[model samples]
Target: MDIKDLLQTAIYQAAHKAIADGVFADHELPQVILEVPPKKEFGDFATNFAMQAARGAKTNPRVIAEAIVERMNETWMEKAVIAGPGFINFYLKTDWLYTMLADVLTQGENYGNSQAGGKEKIQVEFVSANPTGPLHVGHGRGAAVGSALVNLLKAAGYDVASEYYINDAGNQIDNLAASVHARYLELLNQEIDFPENGYHGEDIIDTAKGIIDREGDAYLAFSVEERLTKFKEIALQEKLAALKADLASFNVYFDVWFSECTLHQNGALEKTCQVLKDNGSIYEHDGALWLKSTAYGDDKDRVVIRDNKIPTYLAADIAYHRNKLERGFKKLINIWGADHHGYICRVKAAIGSLGYSPEQLEVLIVQMVSLYRSGQLVKMSKRTGQSVTLTELIEEVGTDAARFFFIMRSLDSQLDFDLDLAKSTSNENPVYYIQYAYARIASIFRQATEDGITLSEIDHSKLNLLTTECEIDLIKKLGEYKEEIIDAAKERAPHRIARYVHDLAGQFHTFYNQCRIKGVDRDLQLARMGLALAVQTTIRHALNILGISAPEKM
Candidate 1:
């Protein structure tokens, strides 16, 4: 058990005892707010339980605080006090923290993982960008966040499936094929005008020339319509392949690549529409098919099919969500860009119309990332094909730096990715700072082993000698790991974990600067080595959770 759990257990027992003593009306346990004290003198953990209990007890909060403080009797309990505004602060004994190293060594990488998630079947759909072009920096940020969130959820004991939605059956495919044809014509010394909305990137020219070289004149025999659709399908498959390769290079692999074209091919789209029609959630108006999304808190009714009898993209989305539910995913999470905020309500309304509760679906909209080169925004040119791509950014700065930089901020908060800062791979980079701390400990351990130090034979009682304030501070921080995981999981905020690893690294660095681990008596060396080993274990586990690598050497 972790510190938060330990404190919660005590709070529950105290609340129950107070109820038995007729100090409160209902059996409802009062709210317990456990937080680290602002100053080191305040102790390890502090709670404001008495301030909340005073209303029920009809007395001064300080008296209730004193009453609760008088009841704590665990072995770790060192002292308790009632501070200003009636808060009960806990100062834990040093011995209690010394034993935590045993748990760290025994658990290893599994130190922070827990079974508290209750095992829900969750599907996280993210980075479902169109395959018409290479992914940009915006997509990279989403990829990092989505991958890290999946790992965080899995560590919390949820059964998670990661998915990437492919938007292949759309007008974008037609434009892409036309662009490729125009590029091919240009390559053959024949003048051809590209369509107004065709992709103009140089990559399209290369792909077109490749297709012409491989397929020769075989496409000439087919009719115009047949040629266009076939070329579009082939180009889309190629595009998806390239995307998969790029993501693989970044260490992001999805379990599913659900194609929008699949829904249309299998008649599932039409069938879902019929279900909505039969359920009275859809109606006809002005020769157009409309869904009554307004009944479920949507801003207004939306058209599923236009008056021209062509289904809109909304119709396809409804079918896709229905397919997700049909596959037995108890929870569906979509990581959408913030620009799609308006789509959330209508989609949830559609889910409700499809016989599933709106609660089953969740949408997390990540804000945009502002790209800065030397503290200046890089303007995307309209004519020149010099837009920044994910591959380009990764080439400039390695994948590790890109991934860490992308996830360093909250998803909802707009991020400013500094190119110069990310390119610097030294300790100036926060990623390297954490990795170097782990590396430093690994180096020390290797030196200790080579000097004939045997960690396994170290006596357990010697661990109690780690009574320095800096050492105990680190133990207190380690004790908060479980709570950090729970908070990140519940809040759907993986950035919190990233921030936590940096702070832990900072604590380890401070401890390293203030003390020496080796070159002492055998017993002192063993105790100090145990502390260093615990720090190494924590840094490794934290980096693993974030889907990052902790190098053994700088």
Candidate 2:
């Protein structure tokens, strides 16, 4: 058992024993929650178990704490003291550190892997941007967070499927087709007015050029309806292909590419509407179908079908979620842009009206990303002549730096991405800092090997030599990897892993500075080598989870 399990088990047994001995009135015990003390003086770990049990037992908190501390693991725990009105702080012996270090070395790359998720199936849909243009910086943020979330969930042992929902059935597709037609006519020296609401990105012109090169004036001979139908299919294919390539370059991939049109084509949208009608969750009002979303906590009822017998976007979304549940996923996670915040309530309400709990669907709203260069807010990419594209960002900074910067904060918080900082190779750049930690350790091993010293399997018995303050701090950080991944997965927060790996990097940097690994005593050097090996392995795994690279040599 880990330190947490040991303490919790001991505390539970002590509380039960206290009640049995009539030391306090019999009452239910409170759940134990332990946290590392913010400062070293507070002890290694702290818990408020006594504070929680005091009220139920009708006894003083210190008295309850006294009862719990008297029964902890004496072999590993040096002392358990009561502080600040019943919080129990545990100061542990150093022997546990040796054991933890040995475990780390043994586990190697799997040190942080946990089966906490119990293999429950989960679906994460993200970056469902329309195919009208290249993905902007905003979409990049969602892609990074979404892909990292998928990786994090899998690391926590979930049966995860990453997906991209294509908005192919909407007006956006029409606008794209119209835009391509206009560009195609212009390229062929024919006069035609572009649709006022059409996409105007440079990509439309490229699409027109590509079509002309592939089939010169062949489309012009067809009827306008036939030509539009063909263009829509061709443009969507090309746009999706380009989108896949860009995401692949950014190290993001999806298991499914679910199209919105599929819901309509397979009659799922109409089927769900009929189901809602039969259940009285929807009604006809003003010659339109309306969902009574207000009953399920939405601000107001929503229209599923308009007066023209056209299904609204919300109707398609309802069908999509039902399809997710029907596929047997226990949870559905959607990463959406911040502007979609108002749509959350009605969508969740739709899920409820369809006989599923709204809790099954979770939406993460990703805020906007503002790029800054030379202390000035950059609004457009000179290369694209529009909003900065993900491709542009990757080209300027790099995939590793871009992914790291996008997820440096929570999804709800707006990000001010510094173009200058991310490009810099200095310690001020956080991604470079973390990557350098891995490289620095690798260089140390190289130096050792060059001196005719070959590092073998870690001698677990030599771990006892690691006793310095720096060594303990590093070892403790190594032990924290498991808890960090578990907590990060529980909260659906990948930013926590970013923060954790950065902290781990800081600890390793300190340990390397204070402890001499090479030219030290043979046993001490081997112990330090074991520590360095574990730190490097954990760093690589953490960076991999974030979809970033940890270069062995910077």
Candidate 3:
């Protein structure tokens, strides 16, 4: 159970009773409010219900606090203290803390999962990078955030679908085909000018050679345009396959790969345009079809179709969202890079004009990831193949460390991923520090079982032997897991989980430094053993949510 939530519920009950007993007027309470005192002297959980009730009672806050304390049951807490100008603080009994360990043991890996989001269907679309080249560090940030967010929402009882949108029928695809064919001709020792706006990455050349080796002469005899169409078809699939493999290794799996081309093929784009046109949201200006996105908070009108009749990227995106709504998702979350911040208004405007509530869509903007190696910026040039690829980072630092490092910062904050720091085998690497806490606990448990000590043999009532302040502090933090999961899911901020795990591991490390578990006292030994198991379980669960692994040993 979540102790904080439980305490909030109890305080609400007390306030309600006070109102019913004519101690305060009705409708005076603020629904619910709970806060932790700034100092330990103030107590574990404090509330200002008395301050809220004072205006209703037409009296001072201290008088209301005294009367409420008189009515509060001592069974729910050790004592009630009204100190420091009428703050009603509740100090839970030590027995309550000891009993909480049983809850932790019973919940185990599910200690923090909450039912806060009910059963809403939420879709998260992220890392929709064009399938023209390998994923770079910026894409890595989105991958980490999106993957972790899916896990968080799942834990919070939301039905989440992780999705990727492909831009396969766009000018970018044409450029990719041209670039590949140029590189193919170069490999065949033919002099040809590279296509304008074509990809220059050496990886593109590699794809060209692989394609030519596999499909020789069947494409060589065709006209350049025909060959390139096929070349792009082949190269786009190949690049997307490689991208998927990289993401899988990084522990990101999507529930759907929505094709932008398929939407156009099925006439969904035209249907969406007609919906807007029938709603009078479109107009013809300068022989070009325009969307009045500016009417719904967009900075300017966007072109849906050019004068030549080719649909713009925004048109495809609008239709794609329409398809998403058709899929029965009430809430849509789109995670984009910081550069796409300006695109948010247009998309929301289009969704709003489609008669769907724009509030149903949530946009999370993930900032860029800057690579630092040996304390210097590492420049990336796709043409030179000198930039760091997501695959290379995974190979160098291992997937767990790479993911942990990438998600350590908030999405709005630019992440400075230090190559040197992440690869270190020292305490400075946070992933290792958390894993070490679990590993150390695993050692203690293994040794305990080797000496014929089993968890079933320990008595729950004897848990009072764990009275150290450090022990109490660890349990207090463990009690916060449910709240953390709810906050992380509601905010779409997975970095908070990383931050929480680090704090829990830091407490465990401090406890290990101050106390020894294997001793002559059996009850103390069992209590400490249980604490170790709790830390191990917390570390494992938190790492699992972040798509990182928690190994029993390094």
Candidate 4:
């Protein structure tokens, strides 16, 4: 149950009744916003409905608060008080806490889920790393964030599909081919110049070596153009396979792996260009076709087709987004690198030019990640040629730590991933600490089972005995789980879920330390056991959404 929403509804009903009874001579009511007060003594929840309605009601806010409070039916609420210029504070009875615990138990793995999204169809495209090199640390961060966001949206009842846009048909592919060809020649003891912008990753060299080992230099007799084309095809497949393997290892899986080449082959690119031209959004300029993006709030017009008759990346992107819309997705969310922030307006402009609201597309820019080890930046990797590969990071820190740490910070904030801290087994490691809470709870249950107590035999009637400060606080945190997920989904902020689970784990630890479960009275022990199970359920749900595991033992 959403307590804040419930309280808001109650307050709205009370205010509406008061207005109908002519207590306040207002024909219109302001939107009610309920919030948790900064201090526990203030109340469980505080609302500024009265203050907001003051101007509409033409009365003092404090007086309006009094009118609403007097009309409020005290069913779930213990009492209501008017405080500080018209805020109404509500203290709910302990019965809601008992109900919350029961809900957690009943919901099981879906304890924190809700139907807040109304089943809107959303497509989340992320980690569309170019098929030129192995996925690096930054790509790993995007993978983690995007996958978790998909999970978050799904839990909130959205029909969400995760997608990866493969940048296969680009100059980058040509460069990859060139790099592989050069490496192939090197393997055969032939001298060839590698392009300055060619991919120099160790993986590319490995691919080249594998080709030579299998084909035995037969390609040397082929024309350079044919050789480059064949090599590009091979390298693309290998790189894509490696990317899939690494992402799978990190527990990041996409529902669709979309090929950029398909856009061109299926004539979507031409179709998109025709739409732009028909809508007067494109113009021929300087021997090239340019989209009049400036008319739609871009910094300037952009080239859709170059003077050489090659469609620019923007053209392909426009077609990709249009294709997404044509597929009947209600929303499109793209997780892009921070460097693409300037590209947002143009993409949005393209959407607008295509007769769709720019609001239909949302772009989340993920900032860069800097790896630190022993207080020093570690940049290079032997496995991925130059940059640290996501596979290597996973190998070092494990998938759970890699995913948890990647999303511990907001996507907009640059992350400093501490290698030492992530691998540490101490409480200083946030993932470890959270998992330890789960393990500790599991141990309690195990001990209970050994003592001839089954979970079904627990005396749920004694749940009201859990009235200590820590117990109440823990229950309150558990109640906030659903709200946290809803807020995270609404804001497109998956990091909020990470923060929530961490905070919940901290609260559970506090309760575990303060309340004894083993030697207490059977009634209190059973009640505490129920609470522990509820916490374990919540932690598991939270971690599951994050694609992280909640271990039964540390």
The per-model lDDT (C-alpha) reads: 0.84, 0.91, 0.86, 0.90
Query: Which is superior by TM-score, 1 or 4?
Result: 4
Model 2 steric clash pairs: none
Error of 4 at 30 (Å): 2.3
lDDT of 2 at 440: 99
Candidate 4 yields a Cα-based lDDT of 0.90
TM-score of each: 0.95, 0.98, 0.96, 0.97
Q: Candidate 3, TM-score vs. the true structure?
A: 0.96
lDDT of 4 at 1: 34
RMSD of 4: 1.4
| Per-residue alpha-carbon lDDT of candidate 3 for residues 1-554, written as tens digits (9 for 90 to 100) | 35666677767777667768877667656644667678877788888877876776677888778877877674758788997667888888877777888688778888888789997999999999999999987899899989999998999889999999998988899899899889888888779899889888878978987977887645668898898888888898899999999899999999999899998899988899999999998899998889899898887999998999999999999999989998999999999999899999989988998999888889999988888889988887434556678887887788989899988899999889898989888889998888888888887778888999987776767777889999998888887777889888998899999999999999999999887888758888888878777778888889999999888776
What digit string (tens of lDDT, one per residue) describes model 2 on residues 1-554? 78777777878988888778777778888899989899988888899989898898999999888887765556788888899898999998888889888988888878888999999999999999997779888999999999999999999999999999999998999988988988999999999998999988889999999999999999999998888888899899989999999999999999999999999999999899999999999999999999999998887899999999999999999999999999999999999998999999999998899899999999999998999999999988887668889999999999999999998799889999999999999989999999999999999889988876656845899898999999998998888889889889888899999999999898999999899988898778888988999999999999999999989898
Compare candidates 1 and 3 on lDDT and give the better one.
3
Name the candidate that leads on TM-score.
2
By TM-score, how accurate is candidate 1?
A: 0.95
Error of 4 at 338 (Å): 1.2
Q: All predictions: root-mean-square deviation over Cα?
A: 2.0, 1.1, 1.9, 1.4
Query: Which scores greater on lDDT, model 3 or model 4?
Result: 4
